[model samples]
Target: MDIQVTKIGMVSCSGEELPEGTISRIACRKVLTDLKPNETVTICLPLFIAGGEEERKFAKKYPTITVDGCEKLCAAKSTEMFSGKPSKSLVVPDILKKHNLSAPKKLRHFGDEDQAAIQAVADEIAKSVKEVLEND
Candidate 1:
């Protein structure tokens, strides 16, 4: 049988909306869509308090991809703590730097810069997922 793969997003906080154009959420969605139908993706926001146990069980049965929005590494850290090892990790800042992009100063609100950043990160994640699936 093929290994089940799960894509998970771990954000720092749960209440605030992501800056406009930030691709973190969208990139996450794209990654989920790109996965094989048998695969699963879970977006574990900070507010999610009840499903950790179920998620933990599901994670053990699949390859999990964790995407972190900033240097804080919230998502990656959480996944490691919960699931042991994330199959892949996509860090937003690293993606931005890879594309020579800079975050805006007033990123407290969503905007064009935020969108670009999200897209860059999303694109990288989508590509990574494709490669993994293909190789498997």
Candidate 2:
């Protein structure tokens, strides 16, 4: 027998101004595509905020995690405003600080040093996915 579970939605902030935003998006893609493909669905921030009914409905029905690039918490705040509260809110900068990793300064293009931040954030997102699934 196989038991299937509902996938968690990951809402990543679409901030392009800061490197952390780039990190946030990259980390989320890593988690969604490689780390937790079976456990997560990507919710486009632009669409979610632009009144995407499907996105909003998915958030309301399933457990969602918002990954924000900075302290502004754009993804988290927008999620709460449009849909409901997210199960977890992962901040890239905070995660970096917690893991003692420095935020990558490069924008569009990243260097070898940036990989640590990406991996760390991806790991955090994957970890959050597990916790939310377990608690669900």
Candidate 3:
């Protein structure tokens, strides 16, 4: 039998209203682009929530990580509802709290210089990706 191992699926929040959401999205991109280019993939929440089966299908077959923006954990909840529970779930606010960092004042505009929170999130996400890939 021919078998294939899928790449890690990243499901992030679609919250455009919160800064943490932006951070979550950016961090996921950073992982996909810089950290683990060939080992990870992202599923757009809009499509995932719109009854799109592509993301659901991928999640069902592979380990997925839900990157939630806040305590609501919309991404994680959605992933669980549509597919199996994610292998790992990360909350941006929780990461910031762990690092004793404050969120940016603006929700949408993060200057290049003020990337402490973004870096924190990206780094943690990268670490999680490494762990998942290693276990795979």
Candidate 4:
């Protein structure tokens, strides 16, 4: 017997140089690991861009949500360029502004102070995942 389960592909920004980028990655980790572990899968931006067959194929076959840490939108753009347009795209700074939260300054290590921003971003990513699933 073969059955298929619908899954949402999550792509997080690869911008490690910015604090927002770190926040984006952390948020995505939470969503993949804690928030939507069973419903979502991570589509790494670097590996996808490097032409990973599995990553590209999955993005092409399933709905995807992109989380961008900066205005450049590296994750979303790359996903669109390599596979197809993401069903939902989220920006970290915009998410913070929308939630009335402050971004953490630490680029490498996050403390309790960064929890709000991290949680907000993770929540948004989880929401996006749900949205894509519902639409599918």
Residue lDDT tens for model 3, 1-136: 1223748889999888988999899889998899877778898888888888877888888898999989999989998998889889999989999999888778887987549999999889888888987887
Candidate 1 stretches greater than 4 Å from native: 1-23, 33-40, 47-51
Ranked candidates, highest TM-score first: 2, 4, 3, 1
Candidate 2, position 120, lDDT: 95
C-alpha displacement of 134 in model 1, angstroms? 3.0
TM-score of each: 0.68, 0.95, 0.92, 0.94
Extract clashing residue pairs from model 4. none
* 8-118: candidate 4 lDDT, tens digit per residue: 888999887898999988888899899998888888888899999899999888888999988899999999999999999999999999999888877869899889999
Task: Give the per-residue lDDT of model 2 (tens digit) for 1-110.
Answer: 12135699999999999999999899999998899988898999998899998888888888989999889999999999998999999898899999999887677699
Local lDDT at 23 for model 2: 93
User: What C-alpha lDDT do the candidate models reach, one value each?
Assistant: 0.57, 0.90, 0.86, 0.88
Which residue pairs come into collision in candidate 2?
A: none
Quote the lDDT for 122 in model 3.
Answer: 87
Best by lDDT: 2
What is the C-alpha local distance difference test score of candidate 4? 0.88
At residue 124, candidate 3 shows an lDDT of: 90
Candidates 3 and 4 compared: the better one by TM-score is 4
- Tell me the lDDT of model 2 at 101: 92
Off by over 4 Å in 4: 1-4
Q: Which sections of candidate 3 miss by over 4 Å?
A: 1-6
> Whose lDDT is higher: candidate 2's or candidate 4's?
2
lDDT of 3: 0.86
